[model samples]
Target: MPNAAEILVDTLIAWNVEVVFGLPGDGINGVMEALRKNQDKISFVQVRHEESAAFMACAYAKWTGRLGVCLATSGPGGTHLLTGLYDAKLDQAPVLAITGMQFHDLIETFTQQDVDLTRVFNDVSVYNVQVSDAAHMENVASLACRTALARKGVAHLSIASDIQEQPADAAKRSKRNRPAHTPQDMFAPHCLAEDAELDKAAAILNDARRVAILAGRGAIGAAAELQDTARLLKAPIVKALLGKAVLPDDHPYTTGGIGILGTLPSQQAMETCDAVLIVGSTFPYIEYYPQPGKARGVQIDCDAQRIGLRFPVEAGLVGDAAETLRALNKRLEQKRDGEFLGTAQNSMQKWREMMHQSEDSSAHPLKPQRVARAFGERLAENTILAADSGQNTELAARHVDLGVGQAFGVSGALASMSCGLSYAIAAGIAFPGRPVAAIVGDGGLAMQLGEFSTAVRYGIPLKLLVIKNNMLNQIAWEQMMFLGNPQFGCELQPIDFAKAAEAMGGKGFSIERADDVERVLDQAFAASGPVIIEALVDAYEPMMPPKMPRDYAKNFRKALPQTPNRDLIEENVARQPAKTMMEAGE
Candidate 1:
């Protein structure tokens, strides 16, 4: 008979989970032993921090539409998984988090690692439970996995130490009173809106002369359908940050991203269009969207709750993005007038030219945009790009051009730091032979630099582009623009990230001058094993939005005299479109 720990591992294998990311501790000795015994069935990836394990699991689920599993011990180890688990919860990724508890008998007796994990995980998990009996181990594990996949969120199961070591009870398992065995394979149902609903949506869309389409993460696998619909409607597709890879940036119909990290053309299209079709996007910036009654709206989302959550829609179609778009396309009339899309495309071209000028700057201190551009140009066709949350995200959103087979993601919704490296590591583990890269700001990378060793230990060939500015550039700009205050408490001491990577048994490269950006990135990308390219960037480079708010300009002007390096900040601001476009109205 198999022990409860073995039963849990076997259940995971039945679900076709290929890898489990976690750290070992005394409380999980039985589970660790079971994993060691079944090494050939599944792979165990040991990470430095429990947080990284969770982040890796979330990223794994995001890239591959499969259940990502992560494990941790009792107390602090289990608690440490909260941040990353929340990332999965907010991003709607399917992940199973297995945690160990203290002995079954000593759970509430002030044991060394006896924390109430169920209560702690309640908010983050779609299904949270603790296993008390060995006979119920498989049942609980199966339920957790099913619920996670069904809900597209986190599922947690905490096993007691004593129960983990106990043998499965054959008598209890064979009892007819037990529930029916859950199937190993699960598939998403094909959901589509009713014919009348589709007709209503199609009528609204076909009546409008100037229409705009907004795509989000739910539209990921529907690229072909999305493009076909855009062509039929003569609509310009504006992507959310998470949906940046839905359509390539250089595509003729795409206006790129929206919101703070958006292109000028995307913002202009949203404001001017008479009608909007929002596909699987919950873009929160209400100010950037077409005013409430300005445009007749239609929205599509897999989850019914998210439909019309951001913008008021005349037709709220509840179904899969691709299916709904395909059905709607059949009903829509092909627009012969191409003026709206052509005008948007022309604005996108101008935006691209301005961006190229920034990327080709010959300044003494390297521009971060240039680094991102070089990194994007060097990526392989199948490379997966993970971007950290900061100014680097802005740079990547604008400059990184994803190719046909490429993938890109950020800690969307949660916007957590320290997730970039873990995401890259997970991508490498999931795809193996394919290339993976991370674009991280200095502050974000400093949060989880220890994970570099995890990549080195696993021999994952990861290319890291560290944009070194020695400051929390995003927060500083927000203080100046949003609060009418000078930057404060945002400065960071400089560190040689290249040297740090070399010390951790990985290859390292540095780029100080603007001319060295391309050569260093090429060398780092071509290097065997893991490599880090730390590029020193100018700190005063502003992350400007496409259309600057009036108050933001007033605030920035008020803080200029008090701000450090005002000349450099002003110089960069002059080159941005915000100055000329501000008076055009928000």
Candidate 2:
């Protein structure tokens, strides 16, 4: 009979888990041994930190739409997994975290590294359990994976160090010798929209003169359906960042992302639309929704609880995003008049103009938008861009066009920084032939710079684009915009990131001039192994929404020329052309 650890690996293999991300430790020796024995069946990725293991696992799940697995030893190692696991939990990504614990007998005896991992992991995981008995290892392992995939959240399994090496057949079997549960057989199909729900939603869309559609990650596989629905309704499509891939940014009806990282056109569409259809998105920002009672709303999500949590929906369709959209498309009457779409197109044109103006800047300090644009232009059509959370997200949302077959992933609900590098690493592993780039700010890069070693070690060929602004630019801008407070504790002494990459045995390039952006990026992209590019960008750039609140406007004006950099605003304005071109096919 197989050992408990071997049984655990077998169960994971049966569930189709391809790779496990983790760091080895003494407490996990038995599990590690099992992994070593099964190396040919499943792959293990060793990362620098346990937190990074979780982060990579989360990213792997996000990129592949499958359950990502991670492992760690007891106590501190397990504690380190919490942040990344929380990232998966809040983002609704499925991940399974396996941790080793001290021997079960030594639990209350003050054993070294004897932390109560079960209690510690309770909050971050949807399902958590400790496997103390060898016979139940398969059951616990299988259930944890199933629960995570079913609930679309994090699951935790804690195995005692000693029990991990015990024989699985030692415990009593059931009377009939029933087979173990297979996830594929036990998994429930996603809910589909009801006929009445679809009809009601279709009627609302057909009656409304102006419509807006919001798509999220749930709409990933339904791109053509989403586009057709948008065309039928003559609606403007606004994506939550996670749904950035649902439709190309250059799509005539798209207004880009909504909220802080949103475009002006998208915000206007939400405010002015007569009706809204929210599909596959549980975007938490309620303020970004159309004002209450201003527009009728219909929400479609597989999870019923999220149907109308943000907006008051006239009809809530509980079903798969694609399936519901397809059903609605069949019933809804296509709008003939294009007035609403035209207005949206005009606004989108202006938004694109502003973005282009920023993209084409020749300002002395350099424009971050230009860097994003250059990379977007140069990357392979199927490249994956993993962005960091911060002002860089704003830059990416506005400037990076995913229309050229690019895919995007970020620390969405958690809105955490430092995930960019790990995400890029996972994407590289997931799609080895495609280019992967992590667009991170210096502040975020500093937090997980050690992960650079992981990239180099694995030869993942991940590109690191560091916007070296030498400050916590997002928080600094927020301090000024929100509270009218001067920036505090946000400044950083500039570091030569390129040199640091060189020291770490990776290629590095540093660009301070606006003109050098494309050339340096091209060189970085062509590098055979891991590459890091340090781009010096204007520190004073504002990470503002399309529209600012009245009080915020007053505060922002008062903090005029926020950056000490002279002629920054004037330089930016002087660089704008007389008329903005409608480059996005408007």
Candidate lDDT values, in order: 0.90, 0.84
Question: For residues 1-586, what per-residue lDDT tens digits would candidate 1 score against the true structure?
Answer: 8888998898899888999999999878888999999899899999999999999999999999899999999999999999999999999999999999998888889979779999999999999999877678867888888889999999999998888888875425556436437666676767799999999999999999999999999999999999999999999999999999998878999999999899889999999999999998887778889988989999999999888888899999999999899899999999999999999999999989878888888887788888889888998888999999999899889999987888998899999998999999999999997898889999999989989989999888899999999999999999998989998899999988899899999999999998888777778877999999998999988877788888988898899899988898888777745444454444
Most lDDT-accurate candidate: 1
Estimate candidate 2's RMSD in Å: 3.3
| Pairs with backbone N, CA or C atoms under 3 Å apart (clashes), candidate 2 | none
Q: In candidate 2, what are the lDDT values of residues 1-586, reduced to their tens digit?
A: 8888998998888889889999999889998999999899898999989988998999999999899999999999999998899999998899999999999899968889979999999999999998867667767788888899989899999988988889867756566535465444345666877788788888888999999999998888889888899989989899999999888889887889998788778888899998999988988899889999999999988889887889999999998777788888999898998988899899888778777877888877887888888877776778898999898888777788886478999999998888899999999878776888778999988888888988888888777889998989999768767877666689988888898898888999999999898778878888888899999998866666677666666665566555454365334423433112111112
Off by over 4 Å in 2: 171-186, 557-586
Worst 10 residues of 2 by lDDT: 577-586
Candidate 1 wrong stretches, greater than 4 Å: 170-180, 577-586
TM-score of each: 0.97, 0.94
RMSD of each: 1.7, 3.3
